[model samples]
Target: MCRRSSGYYAPTLAALALSATLGLAALSAPVAARWARTTSVAIGAGLLVLTAIPWWHGVTTKTPLREMPVHGNWALPGEYEKIGRKLGAAVEKAPVRSAGEVGALAYFCECQVVDKFSDRARLVERINDARERSWLYRLNYLMLDTDELERDRLKPDYWLDWRSGPNVGVGGWSTTGVYRGSGHFELRPDRPAHKPHPDDQGQLPSQASK
Candidate 1:
Protein backbone atom coordinates (compact mmCIF):
# COMPACT_ATOMS: atom_id res chain seq x y z
CA MET A 1 0.00 0.00 0.00
CA CYS A 2 1.38 3.37 -1.01
CA ARG A 3 0.83 6.20 1.45
CA ARG A 4 0.53 9.57 -0.28
CA SER A 5 2.08 12.41 1.65
CA SER A 6 0.26 15.70 2.12
CA GLY A 7 3.35 17.44 0.75
CA TYR A 8 1.85 17.28 -2.75
CA TYR A 9 -1.02 19.39 -1.49
CA ALA A 10 1.28 22.07 -0.10
CA PRO A 11 0.82 24.74 -2.78
CA THR A 12 -2.98 24.90 -2.78
CA LEU A 13 -3.19 24.39 0.97
CA ALA A 14 -0.65 27.18 1.53
CA ALA A 15 -2.70 29.58 -0.61
CA LEU A 16 -5.89 28.79 1.26
CA ALA A 17 -4.02 29.14 4.57
CA LEU A 18 -2.81 32.60 3.56
CA SER A 19 -6.31 33.71 2.52
CA ALA A 20 -7.78 32.52 5.78
CA THR A 21 -5.10 34.27 7.78
CA LEU A 22 -5.81 37.52 5.94
CA GLY A 23 -9.54 37.17 6.61
CA LEU A 24 -8.90 36.51 10.29
CA ALA A 25 -6.62 39.51 10.53
CA ALA A 26 -9.27 41.71 8.94
CA LEU A 27 -11.95 40.46 11.32
CA SER A 28 -9.70 41.04 14.35
CA ALA A 29 -8.82 44.63 13.37
CA PRO A 30 -11.43 46.28 15.69
CA VAL A 31 -10.50 44.05 18.63
CA ALA A 32 -6.76 44.35 17.90
CA ALA A 33 -7.05 48.15 17.89
CA ARG A 34 -8.01 48.01 21.55
CA TRP A 35 -5.00 45.88 22.52
CA ALA A 36 -1.49 47.15 23.22
CA ARG A 37 0.58 48.08 20.15
CA THR A 38 3.12 45.39 21.06
CA THR A 39 0.40 42.77 21.49
CA SER A 40 -1.21 43.48 18.13
CA VAL A 41 2.15 43.49 16.38
CA ALA A 42 3.09 40.19 17.97
CA ILE A 43 -0.19 38.53 17.02
CA GLY A 44 0.04 39.79 13.43
CA ALA A 45 3.66 38.73 13.15
CA GLY A 46 2.87 35.29 14.55
CA LEU A 47 0.09 34.72 12.03
CA LEU A 48 2.35 35.91 9.23
CA VAL A 49 5.07 33.46 10.27
CA LEU A 50 2.61 30.60 10.56
CA THR A 51 1.20 31.33 7.12
CA ALA A 52 4.72 31.22 5.65
CA ILE A 53 5.46 27.69 6.86
CA PRO A 54 3.35 25.92 4.22
CA TRP A 55 4.66 28.19 1.43
CA TRP A 56 8.22 27.41 2.51
CA HIS A 57 7.54 23.69 2.44
CA GLY A 58 5.87 24.01 -0.94
CA VAL A 59 8.83 25.85 -2.51
CA THR A 60 11.45 23.58 -0.97
CA THR A 61 9.83 20.31 -2.04
CA LYS A 62 8.39 21.41 -5.38
CA THR A 63 9.76 19.21 -8.15
CA PRO A 64 9.41 20.13 -11.84
CA LEU A 65 8.06 17.42 -14.09
CA ARG A 66 10.91 18.21 -16.48
CA GLU A 67 14.17 20.07 -16.03
CA MET A 68 15.29 22.59 -18.65
CA PRO A 69 18.82 22.18 -19.98
CA VAL A 70 21.44 24.87 -19.41
CA HIS A 71 22.56 24.92 -23.05
CA GLY A 72 21.20 23.24 -26.19
CA ASN A 73 19.81 24.08 -29.65
CA TRP A 74 16.58 22.34 -28.67
CA ALA A 75 16.16 24.70 -25.74
CA LEU A 76 12.67 26.18 -25.76
CA PRO A 77 11.12 29.01 -23.79
CA GLY A 78 11.10 27.78 -20.18
CA GLU A 79 7.35 27.82 -19.64
CA TYR A 80 6.49 26.38 -23.06
CA GLU A 81 9.09 23.64 -22.73
CA LYS A 82 7.78 22.71 -19.32
CA ILE A 83 4.30 22.40 -20.80
CA GLY A 84 5.63 20.39 -23.75
CA ARG A 85 7.47 17.95 -21.50
CA LYS A 86 4.43 17.34 -19.36
CA LEU A 87 2.31 16.88 -22.50
CA GLY A 88 4.91 14.55 -23.98
CA ALA A 89 4.92 12.34 -20.88
CA ALA A 90 1.15 12.10 -20.97
CA VAL A 91 1.25 11.25 -24.67
CA GLU A 92 3.67 8.41 -24.02
CA LYS A 93 1.36 6.86 -21.46
CA ALA A 94 -1.72 7.19 -23.64
CA PRO A 95 -3.13 4.57 -26.01
CA VAL A 96 -3.32 6.77 -29.08
CA ARG A 97 -5.72 6.50 -32.01
CA SER A 98 -8.26 9.17 -32.88
CA ALA A 99 -7.91 12.93 -32.50
CA GLY A 100 -10.40 13.23 -29.61
CA GLU A 101 -8.35 11.18 -27.15
CA VAL A 102 -5.23 13.07 -28.08
CA GLY A 103 -7.00 16.40 -27.45
CA ALA A 104 -8.29 15.26 -24.04
CA LEU A 105 -4.84 14.18 -22.90
CA ALA A 106 -3.27 17.38 -24.19
CA TYR A 107 -5.84 19.46 -22.26
CA PHE A 108 -5.09 17.57 -19.04
CA CYS A 109 -1.38 18.05 -19.67
CA GLU A 110 -1.95 21.77 -20.26
CA CYS A 111 -3.88 21.96 -16.98
CA GLN A 112 -0.90 20.49 -15.14
CA VAL A 113 1.35 23.05 -16.78
CA VAL A 114 -1.03 25.92 -16.03
CA ASP A 115 -1.23 24.88 -12.39
CA LYS A 116 2.33 26.12 -12.03
CA PHE A 117 1.14 29.65 -12.87
CA SER A 118 -1.02 29.62 -9.67
CA ASP A 119 -4.27 30.29 -11.54
CA ARG A 120 -6.61 27.35 -11.32
CA ALA A 121 -9.84 29.12 -12.30
CA ARG A 122 -8.19 30.85 -15.24
CA LEU A 123 -6.58 27.62 -16.39
CA VAL A 124 -9.88 25.77 -16.29
CA GLU A 125 -11.54 28.54 -18.25
CA ARG A 126 -8.70 28.55 -20.77
CA ILE A 127 -9.02 24.80 -21.24
CA ASN A 128 -12.75 25.11 -21.85
CA ASP A 129 -12.22 27.94 -24.34
CA ALA A 130 -9.54 25.99 -26.19
CA ARG A 131 -11.64 22.84 -26.29
CA GLU A 132 -14.59 24.76 -27.76
CA ARG A 133 -12.36 26.23 -30.45
CA SER A 134 -10.83 22.77 -31.27
CA TRP A 135 -7.46 24.30 -30.55
CA LEU A 136 -6.54 21.36 -28.38
CA TYR A 137 -7.34 18.99 -31.25
CA ARG A 138 -5.01 20.84 -33.62
CA LEU A 139 -2.31 21.08 -30.95
CA ASN A 140 -2.55 17.35 -30.28
CA TYR A 141 -2.23 16.55 -33.97
CA LEU A 142 0.90 18.66 -34.26
CA MET A 143 2.36 17.07 -31.13
CA LEU A 144 1.62 13.59 -32.40
CA ASP A 145 3.19 14.27 -35.79
CA THR A 146 6.25 15.93 -34.27
CA ASP A 147 6.89 13.05 -31.90
CA GLU A 148 6.47 10.49 -34.67
CA LEU A 149 8.80 12.39 -37.01
CA GLU A 150 11.45 12.72 -34.29
CA ARG A 151 11.25 8.96 -33.64
CA ASP A 152 11.34 8.23 -37.44
CA ARG A 153 7.96 6.59 -37.06
CA LEU A 154 6.55 8.85 -39.79
CA LYS A 155 8.16 9.29 -43.19
CA PRO A 156 8.19 12.46 -45.27
CA ASP A 157 6.07 10.81 -47.95
CA TYR A 158 3.46 9.39 -45.59
CA TRP A 159 0.86 11.82 -46.92
CA LEU A 160 1.92 11.55 -50.54
CA ASP A 161 0.20 8.22 -51.03
CA TRP A 162 -2.49 8.51 -48.39
CA ARG A 163 -5.10 9.66 -50.92
CA SER A 164 -4.09 7.25 -53.69
CA GLY A 165 -5.69 4.00 -52.53
CA PRO A 166 -5.84 1.34 -49.80
CA ASN A 167 -2.80 -0.61 -51.06
CA VAL A 168 -0.69 2.46 -51.84
CA GLY A 169 2.01 3.07 -49.22
CA VAL A 170 4.96 5.40 -49.07
CA GLY A 171 7.32 2.48 -49.62
CA GLY A 172 7.90 1.31 -53.23
CA TRP A 173 6.76 4.73 -54.48
CA SER A 174 8.77 6.51 -57.17
CA THR A 175 11.45 9.11 -56.37
CA THR A 176 8.85 11.79 -57.04
CA GLY A 177 5.23 10.69 -57.04
CA VAL A 178 3.49 10.55 -60.42
CA TYR A 179 3.15 14.01 -61.91
CA ARG A 180 -0.39 15.34 -61.64
CA GLY A 181 0.04 18.24 -64.03
CA SER A 182 0.30 18.18 -67.87
CA GLY A 183 2.08 15.11 -69.33
CA HIS A 184 5.82 14.76 -68.67
CA PHE A 185 8.05 16.68 -71.13
CA GLU A 186 11.78 16.10 -71.66
CA LEU A 187 14.27 18.64 -73.06
CA ARG A 188 14.37 18.31 -76.89
CA PRO A 189 17.74 16.77 -78.00
CA ASP A 190 17.63 18.65 -81.34
CA ARG A 191 18.29 22.06 -79.78
CA PRO A 192 22.01 22.13 -78.96
CA ALA A 193 22.44 21.98 -75.17
CA HIS A 194 23.45 25.32 -73.61
CA LYS A 195 27.23 25.74 -74.10
CA PRO A 196 29.27 26.16 -70.92
CA HIS A 197 31.76 28.68 -72.47
CA PRO A 198 30.62 31.99 -74.01
CA ASP A 199 33.27 31.64 -76.75
CA ASP A 200 31.98 28.20 -77.69
CA GLN A 201 28.48 29.60 -78.22
CA GLY A 202 29.72 32.65 -80.23
CA GLN A 203 31.79 30.51 -82.67
CA LEU A 204 30.01 27.23 -83.44
CA PRO A 205 32.75 24.64 -83.97
CA SER A 206 32.39 22.27 -87.01
CA GLN A 207 32.33 19.26 -84.64
CA ALA A 208 29.58 20.85 -82.50
CA SER A 209 26.13 19.33 -83.20
CA LYS A 210 24.36 21.63 -85.71
Candidate 2:
Protein backbone atom coordinates (compact mmCIF):
# COMPACT_ATOMS: atom_id res chain seq x y z
CA MET A 1 0.00 0.00 0.00
CA CYS A 2 2.80 2.45 0.87
CA ARG A 3 4.55 1.60 -2.40
CA ARG A 4 1.55 2.93 -4.36
CA SER A 5 2.17 6.46 -3.05
CA SER A 6 5.76 6.53 -4.36
CA GLY A 7 4.74 4.85 -7.61
CA TYR A 8 2.29 7.67 -8.29
CA TYR A 9 4.43 10.63 -7.18
CA ALA A 10 7.99 9.77 -8.32
CA PRO A 11 7.20 9.70 -12.05
CA THR A 12 5.22 12.97 -11.90
CA LEU A 13 8.01 14.72 -9.99
CA ALA A 14 10.55 13.51 -12.53
CA ALA A 15 8.40 14.85 -15.40
CA LEU A 16 8.06 18.28 -13.76
CA ALA A 17 11.80 18.50 -13.13
CA LEU A 18 12.55 17.44 -16.70
CA SER A 19 10.11 20.04 -18.09
CA ALA A 20 11.74 22.82 -16.04
CA THR A 21 15.20 21.77 -17.31
CA LEU A 22 13.89 21.70 -20.89
CA GLY A 23 12.44 25.20 -20.51
CA LEU A 24 15.84 26.47 -19.34
CA ALA A 25 17.53 24.64 -22.24
CA ALA A 26 15.15 26.30 -24.75
CA LEU A 27 15.93 29.75 -23.32
CA SER A 28 19.71 29.20 -23.73
CA ALA A 29 19.39 27.84 -27.30
CA PRO A 30 19.73 30.74 -29.85
CA VAL A 31 17.12 29.20 -32.16
CA ALA A 32 14.40 31.06 -34.14
CA ALA A 33 10.79 31.13 -32.80
CA ARG A 34 9.64 28.32 -35.18
CA TRP A 35 12.59 26.04 -34.25
CA ALA A 36 12.11 26.79 -30.55
CA ARG A 37 8.38 25.90 -30.76
CA THR A 38 9.18 22.61 -32.56
CA THR A 39 11.84 21.68 -30.01
CA SER A 40 9.47 22.48 -27.13
CA VAL A 41 6.73 20.29 -28.67
CA ALA A 42 9.14 17.34 -29.11
CA ILE A 43 10.41 17.68 -25.56
CA GLY A 44 6.84 17.98 -24.26
CA ALA A 45 5.88 14.73 -26.03
CA GLY A 46 8.83 12.91 -24.50
CA LEU A 47 7.91 14.30 -21.09
CA LEU A 48 4.32 13.09 -21.46
CA VAL A 49 5.52 9.59 -22.36
CA LEU A 50 7.93 9.58 -19.42
CA THR A 51 5.20 10.79 -17.07
CA ALA A 52 2.93 7.96 -18.29
CA ILE A 53 5.44 5.20 -17.48
CA PRO A 54 4.14 4.56 -13.98
CA TRP A 55 0.62 4.04 -15.29
CA TRP A 56 2.05 1.81 -18.01
CA HIS A 57 3.90 -0.26 -15.42
CA GLY A 58 0.71 -0.66 -13.40
CA VAL A 59 -1.09 -1.97 -16.47
CA THR A 60 1.74 -4.36 -17.24
CA THR A 61 2.04 -5.65 -13.66
CA LYS A 62 -1.70 -5.66 -12.81
CA THR A 63 -1.08 -4.13 -9.42
CA PRO A 64 -4.06 -3.66 -7.12
CA LEU A 65 -4.84 0.04 -6.63
CA ARG A 66 -6.76 -0.41 -3.39
CA GLU A 67 -6.48 -2.72 -0.36
CA MET A 68 -10.12 -3.44 0.35
CA PRO A 69 -11.71 -6.41 -1.40
CA VAL A 70 -15.18 -4.84 -1.27
CA HIS A 71 -16.78 -1.56 -0.22
CA GLY A 72 -16.61 -1.06 3.59
CA ASN A 73 -15.51 -4.62 4.24
CA TRP A 74 -12.32 -6.44 5.32
CA ALA A 75 -13.43 -10.00 4.72
CA LEU A 76 -10.65 -12.47 3.91
CA PRO A 77 -10.65 -16.06 2.65
CA GLY A 78 -11.61 -18.89 5.07
CA GLU A 79 -8.15 -20.50 5.09
CA TYR A 80 -6.60 -17.30 6.46
CA GLU A 81 -9.46 -17.03 8.93
CA LYS A 82 -8.75 -20.56 10.14
CA ILE A 83 -5.05 -19.71 10.50
CA GLY A 84 -6.02 -16.68 12.58
CA ARG A 85 -8.32 -18.79 14.74
CA LYS A 86 -5.56 -21.34 15.36
CA LEU A 87 -3.12 -18.54 16.22
CA GLY A 88 -5.58 -16.84 18.54
CA ALA A 89 -6.28 -20.11 20.37
CA ALA A 90 -2.56 -20.62 20.79
CA VAL A 91 -2.21 -17.07 22.12
CA GLU A 92 -4.92 -17.73 24.68
CA LYS A 93 -2.93 -20.72 25.95
CA ALA A 94 0.39 -18.83 25.96
CA PRO A 95 1.25 -16.49 28.83
CA VAL A 96 1.07 -12.96 27.51
CA ARG A 97 1.62 -9.45 28.86
CA SER A 98 -1.82 -8.10 27.99
CA ALA A 99 -4.88 -9.11 25.99
CA GLY A 100 -3.74 -6.59 23.42
CA GLU A 101 -0.30 -8.18 23.40
CA VAL A 102 -1.94 -11.18 21.78
CA GLY A 103 -3.59 -8.80 19.35
CA ALA A 104 -0.24 -7.20 18.55
CA LEU A 105 1.11 -10.70 17.92
CA ALA A 106 -1.77 -11.39 15.61
CA TYR A 107 -1.14 -8.07 13.89
CA PHE A 108 2.38 -9.24 13.14
CA CYS A 109 0.73 -12.40 11.84
CA GLU A 110 -1.11 -10.08 9.41
CA CYS A 111 -4.39 -10.13 11.32
CA GLN A 112 -4.68 -6.32 11.08
CA VAL A 113 -7.12 -6.08 13.98
CA VAL A 114 -7.33 -5.07 17.64
CA ASP A 115 -10.15 -6.15 19.93
CA LYS A 116 -12.25 -3.31 21.37
CA PHE A 117 -11.42 -2.57 24.98
CA SER A 118 -14.01 -2.07 27.68
CA ASP A 119 -14.07 0.53 30.48
CA ARG A 120 -10.92 0.16 32.58
CA ALA A 121 -12.50 1.34 35.84
CA ARG A 122 -15.34 -1.12 35.55
CA LEU A 123 -12.94 -3.88 34.63
CA VAL A 124 -10.77 -3.10 37.65
CA GLU A 125 -13.83 -3.07 39.88
CA ARG A 126 -14.84 -6.49 38.59
CA ILE A 127 -11.32 -7.80 39.09
CA ASN A 128 -11.30 -6.47 42.68
CA ASP A 129 -14.53 -8.34 43.34
CA ALA A 130 -13.11 -11.50 41.73
CA ARG A 131 -16.12 -11.56 39.41
CA GLU A 132 -14.23 -11.64 36.14
CA ARG A 133 -11.23 -13.38 34.62
CA SER A 134 -7.93 -11.61 35.34
CA TRP A 135 -7.29 -11.24 31.63
CA LEU A 136 -9.50 -10.92 28.56
CA TYR A 137 -9.24 -11.74 24.86
CA ARG A 138 -8.79 -8.23 23.46
CA LEU A 139 -7.46 -9.27 20.09
CA ASN A 140 -9.57 -10.98 17.48
CA TYR A 141 -9.69 -11.32 13.69
CA LEU A 142 -6.48 -13.06 12.69
CA MET A 143 -6.00 -13.34 8.96
CA LEU A 144 -3.25 -14.82 6.78
CA ASP A 145 -2.62 -15.42 3.12
CA THR A 146 -4.56 -18.52 2.09
CA ASP A 147 -2.01 -19.49 -0.53
CA GLU A 148 0.83 -19.33 1.99
CA LEU A 149 -1.12 -21.30 4.56
CA GLU A 150 -1.78 -24.06 2.00
CA ARG A 151 1.87 -24.13 1.00
CA ASP A 152 3.01 -24.49 4.61
CA ARG A 153 0.67 -27.44 5.22
CA LEU A 154 2.63 -29.58 2.74
CA LYS A 155 6.05 -29.05 4.40
CA PRO A 156 7.10 -31.58 7.07
CA ASP A 157 9.03 -29.01 9.15
CA TYR A 158 6.56 -26.14 8.61
CA TRP A 159 5.27 -26.22 12.20
CA LEU A 160 8.81 -25.89 13.55
CA ASP A 161 9.52 -23.02 11.17
CA TRP A 162 6.23 -21.36 12.17
CA ARG A 163 7.14 -21.63 15.82
CA SER A 164 10.39 -19.76 15.11
CA GLY A 165 8.79 -17.25 12.70
CA PRO A 166 6.04 -18.11 10.26
CA ASN A 167 6.86 -15.16 8.03
CA VAL A 168 10.42 -16.41 7.72
CA GLY A 169 9.66 -19.52 5.68
CA VAL A 170 11.91 -21.35 3.19
CA GLY A 171 11.26 -18.85 0.38
CA GLY A 172 11.10 -15.00 0.37
CA TRP A 173 11.28 -12.80 3.49
CA SER A 174 13.10 -15.50 5.45
CA THR A 175 14.35 -13.15 8.14
CA THR A 176 13.72 -14.31 11.71
CA GLY A 177 11.63 -12.14 14.12
CA VAL A 178 10.30 -9.98 11.29
CA TYR A 179 6.77 -10.24 9.87
CA ARG A 180 6.28 -7.94 6.92
CA GLY A 181 6.93 -4.47 8.48
CA SER A 182 6.19 -5.52 12.07
CA GLY A 183 9.25 -6.40 14.18
CA HIS A 184 10.15 -9.40 16.31
CA PHE A 185 7.28 -10.60 18.54
CA GLU A 186 6.54 -13.89 20.29
CA LEU A 187 4.44 -15.26 23.15
CA ARG A 188 6.65 -15.83 26.20
CA PRO A 189 4.73 -17.90 28.73
CA ASP A 190 7.46 -17.52 31.39
CA ARG A 191 7.50 -13.70 31.43
CA PRO A 192 5.03 -11.67 33.45
CA ALA A 193 1.84 -10.67 31.74
CA HIS A 194 1.72 -7.10 30.37
CA LYS A 195 -0.52 -4.50 31.93
CA PRO A 196 -1.99 -1.54 30.10
CA HIS A 197 -1.37 1.98 31.40
CA PRO A 198 -4.34 3.78 32.99
CA ASP A 199 -4.42 6.36 30.19
CA ASP A 200 -3.65 3.86 27.43
CA GLN A 201 -7.26 3.72 26.22
CA GLY A 202 -7.17 7.25 24.84
CA GLN A 203 -3.55 8.28 25.12
CA LEU A 204 -1.85 10.24 22.36
CA PRO A 205 1.42 9.09 20.75
CA SER A 206 3.22 12.11 22.27
CA GLN A 207 2.79 10.59 25.72
CA ALA A 208 5.79 8.32 26.30
CA SER A 209 5.44 5.08 28.24
CA LYS A 210 6.88 5.01 31.74
Candidate 3:
Protein backbone atom coordinates (compact mmCIF):
# COMPACT_ATOMS: atom_id res chain seq x y z
CA MET A 1 0.00 0.00 0.00
CA CYS A 2 2.83 2.36 0.79
CA ARG A 3 5.08 3.67 -1.95
CA ARG A 4 8.80 4.18 -1.37
CA SER A 5 11.49 6.02 -3.33
CA SER A 6 13.78 3.00 -3.46
CA GLY A 7 11.39 1.27 -5.86
CA TYR A 8 11.92 4.05 -8.41
CA TYR A 9 15.73 4.04 -8.16
CA ALA A 10 16.27 0.99 -10.36
CA PRO A 11 14.48 2.25 -13.46
CA THR A 12 15.73 5.78 -12.89
CA LEU A 13 19.31 4.67 -12.67
CA ALA A 14 18.87 2.40 -15.67
CA ALA A 15 17.54 5.21 -17.85
CA LEU A 16 20.30 7.58 -16.80
CA ALA A 17 22.96 4.96 -17.35
CA LEU A 18 21.64 4.06 -20.80
CA SER A 19 21.27 7.69 -21.86
CA ALA A 20 24.74 8.63 -20.73
CA THR A 21 26.25 5.66 -22.44
CA LEU A 22 24.42 6.37 -25.66
CA GLY A 23 25.22 10.09 -25.50
CA LEU A 24 28.91 9.38 -25.02
CA ALA A 25 28.92 6.87 -27.85
CA ALA A 26 27.18 9.35 -30.19
CA LEU A 27 29.76 12.09 -29.54
CA SER A 28 32.66 9.75 -30.32
CA ALA A 29 31.52 9.20 -33.93
CA PRO A 30 30.02 11.28 -36.74
CA VAL A 31 27.45 8.58 -37.63
CA ALA A 32 25.22 9.36 -34.63
CA ALA A 33 22.25 7.28 -35.69
CA ARG A 34 24.21 4.12 -36.49
CA TRP A 35 26.39 4.42 -33.39
CA ALA A 36 23.38 5.03 -31.19
CA ARG A 37 21.88 1.70 -32.14
CA THR A 38 25.09 -0.36 -31.99
CA THR A 39 26.58 1.34 -28.96
CA SER A 40 23.37 1.13 -26.99
CA VAL A 41 23.40 -2.65 -27.17
CA ALA A 42 27.01 -2.94 -26.07
CA ILE A 43 26.66 -0.26 -23.43
CA GLY A 44 23.51 -1.86 -22.09
CA ALA A 45 25.31 -5.18 -21.73
CA GLY A 46 28.15 -3.49 -19.85
CA LEU A 47 25.69 -1.73 -17.54
CA LEU A 48 24.03 -5.01 -16.74
CA VAL A 49 27.37 -6.54 -15.80
CA LEU A 50 28.33 -3.51 -13.73
CA THR A 51 25.03 -3.56 -11.81
CA ALA A 52 25.20 -7.32 -11.22
CA ILE A 53 28.75 -7.14 -9.92
CA PRO A 54 27.52 -6.99 -6.32
CA TRP A 55 25.71 -10.28 -6.68
CA TRP A 56 28.89 -11.79 -8.10
CA HIS A 57 30.54 -11.05 -4.79
CA GLY A 58 28.18 -13.55 -3.27
CA VAL A 59 29.73 -16.25 -5.38
CA THR A 60 33.24 -15.33 -4.29
CA THR A 61 32.24 -15.08 -0.64
CA LYS A 62 30.18 -18.28 -0.88
CA THR A 63 27.03 -16.45 0.17
CA PRO A 64 23.75 -18.15 -0.61
CA LEU A 65 21.83 -17.09 -3.71
CA ARG A 66 18.23 -15.92 -3.30
CA GLU A 67 16.65 -18.77 -5.14
CA MET A 68 14.95 -21.95 -4.01
CA PRO A 69 16.93 -25.03 -4.98
CA VAL A 70 13.71 -26.80 -5.90
CA HIS A 71 12.90 -28.33 -9.28
CA GLY A 72 9.46 -27.85 -10.81
CA ASN A 73 7.93 -26.84 -14.13
CA TRP A 74 5.33 -24.39 -12.88
CA ALA A 75 5.90 -20.63 -12.68
CA LEU A 76 6.20 -20.96 -8.87
CA PRO A 77 7.16 -24.63 -8.65
CA GLY A 78 5.23 -27.55 -7.10
CA GLU A 79 5.89 -26.58 -3.48
CA TYR A 80 3.77 -23.45 -3.85
CA GLU A 81 1.05 -25.39 -5.62
CA LYS A 82 1.03 -27.88 -2.76
CA ILE A 83 0.79 -25.09 -0.23
CA GLY A 84 -2.03 -23.46 -2.18
CA ARG A 85 -3.89 -26.77 -2.39
CA LYS A 86 -3.57 -27.23 1.35
CA LEU A 87 -4.89 -23.74 2.02
CA GLY A 88 -7.64 -23.99 -0.59
CA ALA A 89 -8.82 -27.36 0.67
CA ALA A 90 -8.94 -26.11 4.22
CA VAL A 91 -10.81 -22.93 3.32
CA GLU A 92 -13.28 -24.86 1.14
CA LYS A 93 -14.08 -27.29 3.92
CA ALA A 94 -14.13 -24.81 6.81
CA PRO A 95 -14.12 -21.16 7.76
CA VAL A 96 -10.54 -19.98 7.75
CA ARG A 97 -8.49 -16.83 7.54
CA SER A 98 -5.12 -16.61 5.82
CA ALA A 99 -2.56 -14.09 4.78
CA GLY A 100 0.98 -14.24 3.53
CA GLU A 101 3.58 -12.39 1.48
CA VAL A 102 2.64 -14.49 -1.54
CA GLY A 103 -0.59 -13.19 -3.09
CA ALA A 104 -1.06 -15.94 -5.64
CA LEU A 105 -1.82 -18.54 -3.01
CA ALA A 106 -4.89 -16.65 -1.85
CA TYR A 107 -6.19 -16.57 -5.40
CA PHE A 108 -5.45 -20.26 -5.87
CA CYS A 109 -7.15 -21.00 -2.57
CA GLU A 110 -10.32 -19.31 -3.87
CA CYS A 111 -10.33 -16.61 -1.20
CA GLN A 112 -10.36 -12.88 -1.70
CA VAL A 113 -6.95 -11.44 -0.95
CA VAL A 114 -7.20 -8.39 1.25
CA ASP A 115 -5.62 -5.26 -0.15
CA LYS A 116 -2.36 -4.46 1.57
CA PHE A 117 -2.54 -0.73 0.89
CA SER A 118 -5.83 -0.07 2.64
CA ASP A 119 -5.97 2.08 5.77
CA ARG A 120 -5.40 -0.06 8.85
CA ALA A 121 -8.80 0.76 10.33
CA ARG A 122 -10.61 -0.03 7.10
CA LEU A 123 -8.66 -3.24 6.60
CA VAL A 124 -9.40 -4.42 10.10
CA GLU A 125 -13.06 -3.60 9.69
CA ARG A 126 -13.25 -5.65 6.49
CA ILE A 127 -11.52 -8.61 8.11
CA ASN A 128 -13.84 -8.50 11.10
CA ASP A 129 -16.86 -8.10 8.81
CA ALA A 130 -15.80 -11.16 6.86
CA ARG A 131 -15.50 -13.12 10.06
CA GLU A 132 -18.90 -11.95 11.21
CA ARG A 133 -20.30 -13.11 7.91
CA SER A 134 -18.54 -16.49 8.26
CA TRP A 135 -16.70 -16.05 4.98
CA LEU A 136 -13.39 -17.57 4.00
CA TYR A 137 -10.82 -14.81 4.12
CA ARG A 138 -7.17 -14.22 3.42
CA LEU A 139 -4.86 -11.34 4.22
CA ASN A 140 -1.59 -11.88 2.44
CA TYR A 141 1.75 -10.98 4.06
CA LEU A 142 0.52 -9.80 7.44
CA MET A 143 3.71 -8.80 9.27
CA LEU A 144 6.07 -9.25 6.35
CA ASP A 145 7.11 -6.60 3.83
CA THR A 146 4.72 -4.06 5.42
CA ASP A 147 4.92 -1.49 8.18
CA GLU A 148 5.60 -3.39 11.41
CA LEU A 149 3.55 -0.86 13.42
CA GLU A 150 0.35 -2.20 11.91
CA ARG A 151 0.96 -5.70 13.31
CA ASP A 152 -1.23 -5.22 16.39
CA ARG A 153 -4.18 -3.72 14.49
CA LEU A 154 -5.54 -7.10 13.46
CA LYS A 155 -5.11 -10.79 14.20
CA PRO A 156 -4.98 -13.50 11.56
CA ASP A 157 -6.35 -17.01 11.91
CA TYR A 158 -3.35 -18.43 10.05
CA TRP A 159 -0.02 -17.09 8.85
CA LEU A 160 1.94 -18.25 5.85
CA ASP A 161 5.59 -18.39 6.93
CA TRP A 162 7.74 -18.05 3.83
CA ARG A 163 9.90 -15.07 4.65
CA SER A 164 13.30 -16.34 5.73
CA GLY A 165 16.68 -17.65 4.57
CA PRO A 166 18.08 -16.79 1.11
CA ASN A 167 15.16 -17.90 -1.07
CA VAL A 168 11.87 -15.73 0.61
CA GLY A 169 9.71 -18.26 -1.32
CA VAL A 170 9.47 -18.86 -5.07
CA GLY A 171 9.46 -15.10 -5.47
CA GLY A 172 13.24 -15.10 -4.90
CA TRP A 173 15.09 -12.17 -6.49
CA SER A 174 11.88 -10.97 -8.11
CA THR A 175 10.56 -9.78 -4.76
CA THR A 176 11.89 -7.26 -2.25
CA GLY A 177 11.36 -7.36 1.52
CA VAL A 178 13.09 -7.76 4.87
CA TYR A 179 13.91 -11.32 3.84
CA ARG A 180 14.25 -13.16 0.54
CA GLY A 181 13.81 -16.88 -0.11
CA SER A 182 11.47 -19.55 -1.43
CA GLY A 183 8.54 -20.66 0.70
CA HIS A 184 8.75 -24.21 1.95
CA PHE A 185 6.44 -23.69 4.85
CA GLU A 186 3.23 -24.68 6.59
CA LEU A 187 0.20 -22.93 8.11
CA ARG A 188 -2.48 -24.12 10.50
CA PRO A 189 -5.64 -22.35 11.58
CA ASP A 190 -5.62 -21.04 15.14
CA ARG A 191 -9.28 -22.00 15.60
CA PRO A 192 -12.14 -23.75 13.90
CA ALA A 193 -14.43 -21.74 11.67
CA HIS A 194 -17.70 -20.90 13.41
CA LYS A 195 -20.89 -20.62 11.37
CA PRO A 196 -22.41 -17.16 11.53
CA HIS A 197 -26.02 -16.94 12.57
CA PRO A 198 -27.25 -14.49 9.90
CA ASP A 199 -30.78 -14.72 11.30
CA ASP A 200 -29.65 -13.27 14.57
CA GLN A 201 -26.81 -11.16 13.20
CA GLY A 202 -29.01 -9.56 10.50
CA GLN A 203 -26.49 -10.28 7.78
CA LEU A 204 -26.78 -12.24 4.57
CA PRO A 205 -25.76 -15.89 4.96
CA SER A 206 -22.63 -16.86 3.04
CA GLN A 207 -23.02 -19.99 0.95
CA ALA A 208 -19.24 -20.46 0.66
CA SER A 209 -18.82 -20.52 4.40
CA LYS A 210 -21.43 -23.24 4.78
Candidate topping TM-score: 3
Comparing 1 with 2 on TM-score, the higher-scoring candidate is 2
lDDT tens string, model 1, 10-128? Answer: 68866765665575556666666445455546666776787688657656675542322122211123333443344445444332221111222234344221111222232333333
Clashing pairs in 1: none
- lDDT (C-alpha) at residue 195 in model 2: 41
- The full ranking of all candidates by TM-score, starting with the best, is 3, 2, 1
Error of 1 at 120 (Å): 27
Give candidate 3 regions above 4 Å deviation.
1-17, 25-76, 93-96, 113-184, 191-210
lDDT ranking, best first = 3, 2, 1
lDDT of 2 by residue, 1-210 (tens): 111134445677777767766775667556555666666677778867976885677666755543221221112222234434554565443322332323223443443322223223323322333322322211211232334433433211111111223444322121121123222223333332354433335432222353
lDDT of each: 0.34, 0.37, 0.45
Q: For each candidate, what TM-score against the reference?
A: 0.22, 0.30, 0.36
**Candidate No. with top lDDT:** 3
